[model samples]
Target: MTTALLLAVVVLGAALQRVSGMGFALVVGPLLVLLVGPVDGVLLVNLCGLLFSLLMLATTRGAVDWRRLALLAPSALVGIVPGALLLAAVSAPVLEIVVGVLVMAGMSAALLARHAPALDGRFAPVVAGAVSGAMSVTAGTSGPALAVYAVASRWDPRSFAATAQPYFVMVAAGSVTVKLLLTDARLPALGAWGYGGIAAGCVVGLFVGRALAGRLSPGRTRAVLVVVAFAGGLATAVRGVASL
Candidate 1:
């Protein structure tokens, strides 16, 4: 029964990631921790995330915007080092609360803003990428930061997904590296099975999400963004409080 529940969580997490480019960790991490343990849950989610990133890259290959990614990617890389260091030192519970508050606040701001300002100028992506990278180490959900920048840049869905792809891939790699270096933390056998389930879920979800992305009107897209932002924020808050 526990094994079945874990598998179901992975599937659901993958579906969430397929639609939003993220959320697997938010959905699966906490539950996995509850069922297994924190360390095991983190390992499982990270592995699944790595596979998911590859799948997303393949699915959105042709549509990627190399230009924006080129601008933002370096900053993300730079930020990850510090983030990794911080993660090594800080307590998980504290990090969770901080991240949760930020998520909620960011969502609130985005929703309340009257106009989406232009953030595509010279330094915005760099700043956003750096922040996203740092946040990834702690929260594993830097998609909100990237999304805000993308929205400001006026990137269409394909370009947004494309530009963000490598960031996720790199962040996942950085996270796994950090985890391996810190301790003798080994991936669980059960997690290996979970990865397959998540991958299958992501594949199906991606197609559906892509189709929905095409049909969404601008207003609807904005609405979705607002909702996701709030969800991310709420997840962060819950994680944070739980840590406390």
Candidate 2:
């Protein structure tokens, strides 16, 4: 992609992430794949996602639930390696298709199970985080798993979105680390000019997204999250099919 086009997508994606709390990858991953090919694009997506969540946490520190982060983050860290290994073991296109189908199915279930029993007991968060981490590495998204947790527990949207910032920060960072260690892929250099463009885009996104976020009600936030899930699922499915 042209430098301007790349910046435009990043800015828009960063804004969506800021507004909805979990859409940077969903909004930008496919486009980046088109721009820079799949592997490099995914690396950029992971890096940009980490940046987005860092800024989010800086702005909304008080809302972070450390207790939750404690459970989710470590589990995610552990889970990423296995997820990467799983990807290595499986056929890429087939695995991606399966992952995409499962994501869509999971989203459907979450929608129906909104009124279903909330998860409890000791290992619930562990399971959620582990699954989230696995998905983050394999599919370049862990948002759907976290989204179901937020909805099933009936968390207030703002609080849920706020808490998710830290989770994304950790998961994105961890995924990048694991991808670096386990895969042959190394992140492509952006150079000084590219970095500057990214920085400017982030600055613009932060301002625009915060302004838009103020307008969302709890219901609307949930609505937006649901839309993000569908988009993520569809994108994954398309990538799978296209690869085939």
Best candidate, lDDT: 2
* lDDT of each residue in 89-189, candidate 1, tens digit only: 88867776786686666555654563756545769889888877777666666677776665556567455655566668887677667767764456776
Candidate 1: C-alpha lDDT: 0.68
* lDDT scores of the candidates, listed in order: 0.68, 0.79
User: Candidates' TM-scores?
Assistant: 0.84, 0.93
lDDT of 2 by residue, 163-240 (tens): 888898888889898888887657777788676777778778878888999998879988888788778877888888
Candidate that would win on TM-score: 2
Deviating ranges (above 4 Å) for candidate 2: none
TM-score of model 2 (CA atoms): 0.93
lDDT of 2 at 150: 66
